[model samples]
Target: MSGADQHIHIEWRGGTCRVKWWSGEYLDNGRKRYESKGGFTDEEVAFNHGRDKLYEIRHGTHVKNRDGATPMSDWLDDWLAAMDHGHLTERGYRSTVENHIRPYFKKQNASVADIDVLAYRAFKKHINAKMKKASSAANIMMVLGMVLDDAVPRLIKTSPVERTRRRGKFVKKPKERKKDMTPQAVEQLACNARTVFGQAGYVFIWTMAMTGMRPAELFGLTREYCYPNWPLSDPRPDDEETERYEEDVERYGRGDNLMPAIRVERQVQYADSTLQFFPPKYESCRSLVVPDFLAELLKDLLASHDHKWVFPALKGGSLGAVNFDYKYWRDVADGADERSGPRTRGARPAIPPVPSFKGRRLYLLRHGHKAWLDEDGHSKFATESRMGHEVPGVEGVYSSVTVPMERAIMKTLQERWDRLRGGSSGSDA
Candidate 1:
């Protein structure tokens, strides 16, 4: 018999026949390959199953079956460790794998080949049972899909979790547009944050609301890159802090007509309880122009503190995400923790709501900034550039943000500030 025919065998286990076979294909590293599949009532079906494994080897769509027998829990762990992830993203991925993916698959012993559309459907069902929000389930699925897609042809033939409508219905919920915080709500959140987190909190929230900066980008801002005065040069250290800032000076310089701007180049993240910094997401390094009102406020902040970070924690360290959320943001957004003490009365003054803000994230302020730009009627190109998103198609080629464009944006923002804050202009800061 040929080598492939010699390797095929049949065995009865648990009142059913199992097909055992050699794939006749060595791994790239020259390791032997084998496969096992059961649940056939007759030897003929078992033989056909063994032949199917040989057929797959003739086609290059699959590799040796070493990883095929490995449990999904172990495979997912290996997959997560093998892929490149930034500190923050790695944290999130690990959480999903540990908290959600592993538990659901704990009883599953089926290898990569055994995992199929039915398995994914069951996983989705588990997710739906556990999660109340469709968005949360969707997020978990996204990460799972990424893992499976990367495992193609090596650990599995193809990703079992397909996005297509298999049975005349879409599997996932239709994408929903996130609601934006209103102008009034944005103003209130900033003011309340100031009261709760002090001046640093005010500057942090206001800057994000006006600038549309990612939270990491906000945490990443430094004194050197903060340009409070429009079209005017700020004092630069003798040594360049970042090469990107130096390149910006060489390429764009301080044009006489340019508006006040902040340099957004890096982002702060946490890994293993330690702080890490890297280029902003997608390397979306850009200068964000500040309105005149915000410029003055930033200048005041810059003058008040000569630290390395523009928005450091009250203590002498970079802000932590957990610390920022629970200590400051949650209290302000959801109202001061319901004041519980032995001497306290039954009820306290009702905490006023900030429209769509209760139980929502501080990032909503950033999303609201985009809505503001859209309402102001800025060109899509300018809006996308300012938001650090790449504008698509030919419009991106022909469209460049001009002096007039900058002025219009600044004027619109200034008008909003004046109208909302009742012409107070925030006390020269």
Candidate 2:
């Protein structure tokens, strides 16, 4: 071989044959680029490999040397920096990348080009083995896939991750659904909370179970958003809110049919030791109808506090994320053991556990509320709307919550409370 045919070269190394192929490209300094690989035992095999490299280079399928050398950790940092996410979302992404992605790739010393199908599968196995929940492992894998896909055609030819559809009878098991709490169980929890953290705790548990509001939403609730007198004290409507106000007034004008409600506008998020208010998840800003009893309960609770938050922390101010779970909720749900203090002056009573709520999360109240709404045979549109979830398709656009729908919800919820308290269904307890 000579002249242009000499662009592909096969030569003997110490103990093996090596191949070098011209890439048919030029550098910024006007020099020809060459790609090479070695360690082939057979001369013919090395020659064939050189020819294949030449073909790939000419077809523009070759990965650039600089891109292939970029480290996985550095690439992930760049991708995360370019993302436009809310404070809370960005914090979560950063946590996942730092805690899982960075460490694994750093240990393997992986580069952008190192994540092929086998490497991706191995990483998935590592994540599954380390993570306690299948859902958490899936989320980590999704983030890795996103990072790899973003490097396409530049750092990588294609992403190694592909979503596979599970088939046949022996498919991957679904996550276990959270258990729903019965009305009696919910009341027991509320009662226990009252004993442990006072009246505020009692009201907090009831509000979550009845309203189906997210924990963040409750943490962010303020006097302006909650209304025991509802439409009577509702703020002046803006141009966009005019039609809603008119409809509300028409439907709830009579004193006998007056309904109380609360507005869901924002939620509290804790990050970097600071509390920030952000729009509700998916921006599902809505008005939620409340039962008369709950309305009165909220009124009394608000009257007792001058703090900005409706459900202030036991020590006052917004509830801290860690403190709420460790100091307050654990004692309330799991029960506290009798203990003696250092000076024997701080001795406290042992609070008995709520059997039904033991080992459960506070978020389960929201789930149980959905189950209750379903049990009561409420319309999908109303129930979903109340839960701050968007209804999809034409049904969402066409169907809306009418006065009768809200009234029925209010009546049933009140009845449920009354029944649980051993009072007549329609009695004012």
Candidate 3:
């Protein structure tokens, strides 16, 4: 990734001294170093400077950043902080350890080039000690490689890890998730809903099963973006185009009779305790086609709620902490049997305590919807768009494009759901 940096720049403020500028690597934050050759008066000078610095930084032969070298733990700590700024979700932070990063190299003091091959090779053996799934191990390897790869330009540290780490068939890929709502779990949770926090949480879970959007996308949803009724739906509301949304929604499904299929354009996030607006996760925004049942649900969800959001309110509109802490939600799900909805009519059975973690992420709905589509033989373009895989370069190219359709994709998914419900493909629910 390097061979792109050069050490030279100019100051734009004072053209006479404009030639005086920043270049090369600077040791940063006690032991870590960052690629430093940018602030230049001329664009070419800055580009050339950073470009060469990346080469030296990644290759690990650079003179400027020798002091930044440290144990793997220190570098990873810095990496975690840096990733906090970039990730749209906490997956980056949580999976790093749970997926087997700490077990092997947590103690090693890694230089740029050395950490790539040998340490990782040892990690592979270490991972096999605990991880039974090949795909899971592969995922850990991928995260390690990506972190090292990022060091290429800024740290100019040589990473033995390559972008692609396909090492034989031992590294099996993870099975794609197809089950959005298992019948037992859904029934148990629905039964528990009425007795606790009312119909709201159940409806939220139902919304996930019915519509294949993510939790953030659901939370960011507003009445203006969703409702087609008078007042709230009125465009150009109070002038100044307070409508940061609906530009594209109107562009596609415009006017009074607009059938707004939820399109994720932006999200409200609480970072540094500040409410910030940014584009949706997976980078590219998409529009999903909801079933007619889900459409009715959305209409009710919009009309019934006084809250600004479709889901229940939490002060700042971010659910980062609430996601992991499912005790409150678990209590609701576990106690739902005694509650009354349409069918229960009260005097329901006593339900058991269930793990709330699985129910927490609304994105599980995406997997369920994709499975149904795959069974129904939907197009690949439709599937990819729904998943929102718009990242660039390697992952983007692989993800955005639809691979050849598999024959078993439908049969397997449908059969699994059927088995869960104690029914066959031809049997009625």
Candidate 4:
């Protein structure tokens, strides 16, 4: 071997051929780095292996030994630490790693390079077997894919996880639209909530149904964020928000002409066994307009409570996310009976189950609010903005919620409430 052939060296050792090839990488000491393989009976086989390795190096698809040696757990830790995520998102990622990823890979003692297509498929099988919910399994797989993707070109040449689009007849069926609570059903739920949690609960149910604010946003609502106070109580706007703030100030100063609104800037998050205030998911901070009826309801509720939070726990202070459903919400939505433990003397009557809300999560109220907005034929920009969702593309950039849209929303919502109330009164007659 001579000239260009010198880049690859083949020698016979104990009647078997060994091959070494320059990796095209240089050491700090001005020396050429080389990689090798052994135990080939034929010299041509060893030479071909060396040629393929050299090709990979030149194409930048080679995974160095030192980089590939990193353990999956260690790599996951580094990947998670480098991610820019909100507190809740970070917590969720950590949970997925600790609860699913670590346990499965721990037995294999897998390294960064050990996970190939077969290994990833095996892991997916294991995840499916362990997780009851398909959604949970999918989420874990997504996190694992992301972690591996971040390691590309460094720890591994490419991620083993492959995402294929469902094509033709294999495409997923459109999801069934979620059921929305009717105005009368919402009223029934609120009355039930009032029985279970007093006036605060009554107002809480109504607020969620009317505004579509997320459960966390409602949980974290402070006195200053509620009607008649927000926007005014908020700190002075930064430079970019100056114009909007001026417009809001002008509108607010218009006495009875003002359409009530709440600012959704923060949410209550539970972490490390303590409740903390964090920005709403995706930091979708926006002002939500409310009907006059809801404004009066909020005013009365605010006057009733001296706590910092607009809606405080029965025992006082911020509401706890843990066991909240088991303790209070289940009774409110599912209803309580003799089996719900002995009723204390002077306790409110057993809550009758709202049929529509049965077996449903509290978050559905927000969904129902969106449904109501759609039913009333509100503008897409106004409805999406109200729901804390950004409309995509050029439309979102150019369109915005104007005063007329806000006023229209408020009027429709107020009318819905009044109609429900009038029906209830007529039934009493």
Best-fitting candidate, scored by lDDT: 4
TM-score of each candidate structure, all chains considered together: 0.74, 0.80, 0.52, 0.91
Tally clashes: model 1.
1
lDDT of 1: 0.75
How high is the CA lDDT of each candidate model?
Answer: 0.75, 0.81, 0.52, 0.84
Error at 99, model 1, angstroms: 2.1
Candidate 4 lands at a TM-score of 0.91
Native RMSD of candidate 3 (Å): 13.4
Q: How many pairs in model 2 have backbone atoms within 3 A of each other, for residues 3 or more apart or on separate chains, i.e. clashes?
A: 0
lDDT of 2 by residue, 241-272 (tens): 88877766655443666777787888988766
lDDT per residue for candidate 3 within 119-191, as digits (tens), equals 6677767776767887777767777776676666445446667455566678665664433445455545544
Kindly report which residue stretches of model 1 are placed more than 4 angstroms away from their true locations once superposed: 1-51, 62-65, 85-87, 106-110, 162-187, 229-258, 334-359, 420-429
Which stretch of 10 consecutive residues in model 2 shows the poorest summed lDDT? Answer: 420-429
In candidate 3, where is summed lDDT lowest over 10 consecutive residues? 401-410
Per residue, candidate 1 scores C-alpha lDDT tens digits across 264-365 of: 778988766777778788778778878888887887887877667787776636665446787767866776644546785443433445646777787877
TM-score: model 1 vs. ground truth: 0.74
